[model samples]
Target: MLIKSEQQLLNFIKYSPIIIITLIAILINSLIYIQNEQNFEKDLEIYKKNYIESNKRLTKFQVEKAYKDIQRERENLEHRLENRLKTRVQEVYLTVENLHKKYSHLEEKELLNIIKESIRTIRFNDGRGYFYIAKKNGFSILHPITPEYENNDVSKLKDSFGNYLYKEIIDHFKTEEEYFGELKAVKPNMGNKKFEKVTYIKLYKPLDIIIGTGEYKEDFNNEIKNHIIREHIQNVRYGKNGYIFIFDYDGYQLAHVKKEYIGKQRIDLVDSNGFMITKEIIKQAKKEPGFISYIGSIMPETGKPAYKTTYIRGVDDWGWAIGSGFYNLDMLKYLEAKKKELRAMNNESLKKTLIISLILSAILIALAFYISNILKNFFTRYHERIENEIQENRKKDMVLYQQSKMASMGEMLGNIAHQWRQPLSSVSTIASGTKIQKELGMLDDKEFDKGMETIVKTTKHLSQTIDDFREFFNPNRVKKEVDTQVIYNKAIQLISSRLTSKEIELKSDIDSTVFVTYENELLQGLMNILNNAIDAFENKEIKNRIIKFDIKFQKECKMPNCDIKECSQGKEGYITITIQDNAGGIAKEHIDKIFEAYFTTKYKSQGTGIGLYMTYEIINKHLKGFINVENSEMKHDTQSYKGAKFTIILPINIEEG
Candidate 1:
């Protein structure tokens, strides 16, 4: 045999109710903890959705603001270009007007000198050098730096240059308006040398003349191109390790970090080494409105992929698209740092939730088992005390029942004496009549018949009286369906002897057809109430002590008189036995408590309080009927006496099994 060790005993103690409750408390607490964790997860999801939506809205707002800024800058540049062009046109117009006004009245030499001075002024203000004056017959009159061409029919010179200049001047003369064109410039001294130039011609209307000015294309473009590019580049911010490029409307490279690529068309920028990014920038800008990343060859100095974010701005008037681009690698570094911080926070929250859940579950389970043990001990004590009180009450009820039985026995003996009195007196009278008839010796046939009839009637009455008393005192258990009239008749018979001795007149108005399920004990209960009524009347010493027993079907048992289904059984039938006497009525204070056990106004020897209590018990508990009492005043020849009326209301057929 093995003995249990201290550790084994300790283990068993740990598994006891207190310990079990601790475990259960822990389980419930864990459920609560897990629920809190789920709630946190739900909140996190909501935060994430809201965060993403907010970022999207912010991105949209930023893009719209950027687009507006680009539009504003473009508008400003266009406005400046427009003002400069308008001022230049106005100055040329003014110079032509002055030339015509001064030369209108001059001689040929003076007019020639004025034309040369005007050409010099045009050259000074307009950045071009060549000018001429022509007559209506296409003869050249004044030529700056070439005075040999004076009075020459220069219009007839067969070359594109001479034709363009002559036609432009003649057209302006006829229309009296200015004309502009581009043409090749030729001079005899500078043979085979070509000049690309712009011409502005105006008619000398007051003098039938035309004056023309020409500006070289190279000189005019040189004035504005560098300034436009410089202004655009200076405002662009590339941050660090990133570069910017600017492209013109035709996808040509206008400016770039690699300055050598400037002015090169996009298609021609590709080198033998295949290091070009202009085509890639243009392709991305055309695909989307703003910022996209694409890979391309990087400039050699940068040593990074030309993976860039490109932005396009359209020049609406020219149907051109301008673009700017930046490299991609610099933007990613910032996003990576934010992602690491979020992951760290998520891991810390998860670890905290798991640890808290386990601790709480253990605490909750212990509390549950501890409370269960305490409640069990409390209820066990309460039930034991209740059982002891019930047994004590039962003993008192038995003693009271025995006392009631002894009192009934004494009343029964009184009833027997009263019952024997009438029959005995009739027998004595018959015997006396027989003795008198024999002494007189005059017993004729008529006298004999009357005496025998008298004898038979007296004997029959005596036999019926004995039968009624015998049924009342019978001790056998009765289980049978008894008629309502039989029960009432029996009750009257039991009380009849007492009624007669007290000179109380007994009258019955009973229904013959009603029946009920009852025993002799119910009849005895009704007799007891009748007996008390006889006593009350006789003791009061009223002139006429009359007890009326009425048995009939109760049409209305309560208000509205609706038949009770369980009691009436489809017929509006109930037996009401009213026992009224000319006795004094019960006092009002004692009426309600008359049915309570050990509650009576009569002396203890005269009446046990349980008479009506037993009557109520027999009718309600055994016979399934009801009893109530009311006081009524009796009138005899205009004299009224108060009497007690006891009503026994019973079902026509009480159910039995």
Candidate 2:
């Protein structure tokens, strides 16, 4: 009912599946792509963070390893310094031992002078090394670098650090034949500033004399420091452009790739943004050894200051800030490559998703068409079955119509005989009388003319009656204009004889309205109703047996389910015929079924049951009108009459069959 037609239904079935699936596919693919894009952004950010964090860790570890290498190399330098001092002190002690042995018979002063002179000229450690001899009572017997303090009772004398330097040295000699210790002394070549000196002393037991020589690191910066910086720290390299650089807190570049940078004050170094990179590195190094960002900083690739992430470390003992970094450009390169890979992967994923959606949509479309085809075939078969059934019913209706026509013909023939009986008798009687008169020679011309004229008139009346009956049963259907009252009177005329034989009174109420319709078919349908009512009166006892035909030009609706636009518009609507009988009302149960074919209450031979069915078929299917029956009460002169009322509504002017 919603689809209205087979083609519309089929079309809907055909296109709906693909349409629905296409929308769903679009929705699903869009969601997937959106979600993937969101995830891509989120994951890329995380990847950047993780990558930067890993590089920071790498830089930190590299700097820490370089720091450890520097520490190891400095320890080696210290060990070598200690070895040189010990070896030189041993040679000077052997010189003293030899001098004491060779001058054993000489005076102690002279022996001491000989030992001092021998050790004095035997300077090692770059001429900053020297020996001294003291008496057993802490008296300075001879001195080389500080000869002004010699030959004095220096028992209360102290070094720059307020220590009794000579007494402590003699006490050490008294206990052990040799000793090694630190004493506050001054380097003659470096002015009179006290410096921590490392000394080795030996006892000359033959003269009860103490001899000592010492070395300090006053010249370390010009020699050993440079060697360590050049060999160890500067030579340490990691990745490309990864070099260890050391600068003191005082801003001197201690170890560097550029020879000019080494041992140069570079604290005021700046980058593109005028940011003091070395100053910031130094600041971070002092607080805690960690990472720092250097925007507009230097890079190896560009050789210009750009962005970099650096790790800074402090070597507090060396007053140095150590820093190493990889450039931001390098990290960007790695991240950019990763981004390109992710983009390719995301595009491929999206492509696959779209392709999969397309494939699924295609499959759904195919499935939809497959199902539509199946339904189409089923509908076609169903349509064929229904068509076959409708055709069979139509054929059966035709058969019933023919049978009803035959029955009506029999009734019409009987009515013709009834009406013609008296006329035939009168004609026969007139002819017999005329014949007798002529035979007897007593019949006059007037009498003969009268008899002959009466016969002619009677026979003409009979012929006219037959013609009306013949027209009533005529099967040829054609549309024509006719008077409604005349048509109804003709229907009553055909069946009036049957009503008379049953002692039924016919009441006529006809409206002289005009109609355009099939004349004979309408007449036949009306005749069937009158005949059916006549038959219903059989064996019925009714005080005032009456059959009424109330026909009129109905302007209002009669049939409840009327489709005529004129009826709704309150125009000249329809011709309504209400045929009722007071013989008796039809049984309630059989009212609805009475119009069906072969439905009858009478004996099979007496009631063929097709009269009303034909009427229904003509009114509903053929004439495009409607008919219904109901048991109702009709009053005439205050007298109640209850019977079956058959109402028929026909369009006042029908344009279609």
Candidate 3:
């Protein structure tokens, strides 16, 4: 019995873990299914909302496109019509003036008769236009359509629309030479109709007659409205059943695809949801042409409550609001189909997931133990690899820095050659003269000594050129106080010969001498900048090549304008060095990139493209100064020239020990 109790306790301990794990797995699966169901519901809601909003935006876009197209057509028509009318009126004016000139020599009655007869026969614009004569006092002398009104004072004649036709014409002609008006007028073969006419009046001073002719606008338009309605508006279709419909701003339905709905008042019409559809559409249209939405109009195929999105636009010329609509039933149908598909997929996936989860649950326990041990080794190796990569990167940076320094040294060598050429030529010339003097029997002791002294001085200058550049490339980090003026002059001396060769004048001003560390690097940077200016003058036809340096002292601050912010807080001032050159300035596109490594505007053979880049890095990093470059009009003395200005803001001496 004791052995049996001990065995039973061992069995219970071994099986208890499996039983508890199975229960937890069941509970976790149930929670996962519930959470997945909730997430699917949330996602479906979001998708439906997003789809509806996107459809609304699409409908608005369609409406605005149509509005722009129609407005453009209207403007084009107005422009053409105005030009045509002016041209037609000018033709009639020239004809009447010629006739008046021809008949002016006859007797008064004869002249009047001849002029009237000549004007009566003239017709233009396909016989729809004719000449008429009127007196300055508003009496009609001739009327082509109405002969009886010619002898009568027809100035007070009112059209069918209560517009005083002749009186308005005479009043307009009193202040202007021409007239364009619309009125009820009699055509030759047709009865009175509203006509827009352009009339021109010529004052015949000799005969005291005002001769004018006008063309009917209806004839000039030539079926433009019908063409626009048929070709432009009616045929323009957008989605499956989308179409344009027109209504006046006051809500009179003028044109629609469904013929029976035309001529109906829609301002008070409501959708199935009781929203005032036409009122909202017209209100939106009357503002700038844009889109408005209202739910109405059922889908014919569905025969259900359908959502419709319409875009509305106003036509100011005809006082009409036009729009098109897209039904949401298509999207709804797609959504419903997708929902059914997703539901089926979810059910299938749930069955598979439950079976798979049971299988995976067993494997997960084994992997948890196995992967932890693997992760420990992986982390150890990963840290070692990262350290190695950092070291490699540091070596690469040093290599790049050395390469850049070599490139700068090569550029300085070119400047050195330019500096030594003149002195070497002078030494050679002096030696040649000394030889010629000895050969010619004119050699004197004092002359020979003077020549020898000059040769020595020139050789010393050549040696000093080498020394200046040799110290520039030294990698020693030595800090010493430097006067700003002295530093500027030293840099200038290195490049002065090259400047002279290019005929570029150097101008400099140093107001206060300030001290800074890394004086040689500063001088090197300044020399590199001056060399660039010198190189820029190559092949340039600037009348006066000039480079300028201006130095001043400015108080430095911890923050911007710290003097006003905190009364007692301050730091040492800065030596501000400005270098400018008049080589027509750097091109604007390349100004920002000039300091970047391997970026140069010069030929590859002429430049290695690291001189200015090293200069920038040296000033900003080694010397702890700020440098900025821009292209602007630099004024030197009395002349203003477009040039590049480089400003170097350098800190004063910081070493205190």
Best by TM-score: 2
Per-residue lDDT of model 3, residues 1-657, tens digit only: 243543354444445445665777888788878876886687678778877777667766766776777667767866666666566556655665676677667787676666677678767667877777777667777887878877678778776678776676677667765556565556788875556664455655556667666556666454455556666766666666666777788888766666566779878978877888888878877887665555755554555546777777787766778787767777777678777877787778788878887887777645554564465556466867877997999999989788777876776776887888889999999999999999999989999999999999999989988987787667777888877777876777777767777888888888857676787788778877888878778888888889888888777633332233221222577677888988888887898899999899888756777889999898777776777888879776788889888887766754332
178-259, model 1: which lDDT tens digit per residue?
6666766653345657677666666656555666665555555544444445654424444453344556556676656667
Q: Cα-based RMSD of the predictions, in order?
A: 29.7, 33.2, 27.3
For all predicted structures, in order, the TM-scores are: 0.38, 0.51, 0.42
Regions of candidate 1 where Cα sits further than 4 Å from its true position: 1-109, 117-130, 135-139, 143-169, 180-199, 202-205, 208-225, 238-243, 247-254, 258-328, 351-657
Q: Which residue pairs in candidate 3 have backbone atoms (N, alpha carbon, C) closer than 3 angstroms, thus clashing?
A: none
lDDT of 1 at 486: 77
Off by over 4 Å in 2: 1-14, 70-76, 94-116, 133-142, 149-154, 159-163, 202-211, 217-228, 295-297, 371-657
Steric clashes per prediction: 12, 2, 0
**What CA RMSD would candidate 3 show?**
27.3
State the lDDT of candidate 2 residue by residue for 1-657, as single tens digits: 389788898999899777889899989988998998898898889888997888788889978987787788777777776776667667766777787778889997777777777666666666787777787777787777777778888778876578776676667666678777777777866666778776776676767777777767546434655776677678777765677788889999887766667878888988767779889989988988988776743455676766888899998876779888877777778889988998899999999999988998998899899999999998887988888998999999999898878876776679998888889999989989889988999899999899989988998999999898778757798988889878877887787677777888888888888888788888888888887888777777777788888888877776776666534332457788899988668898998899999899889867877889999998876767778889989787789988999988887777662
Cα error of candidate 1 at position 541, Å: 84
Q: How would the candidate models be sorted by lDDT, starting from the highest? A: 2, 3, 1
Off by over 4 Å in 3: 1-29, 90-141, 146-228, 249-252, 263-319, 340-359, 365-657
Between 2 and 3, whose TM-score is larger? 2
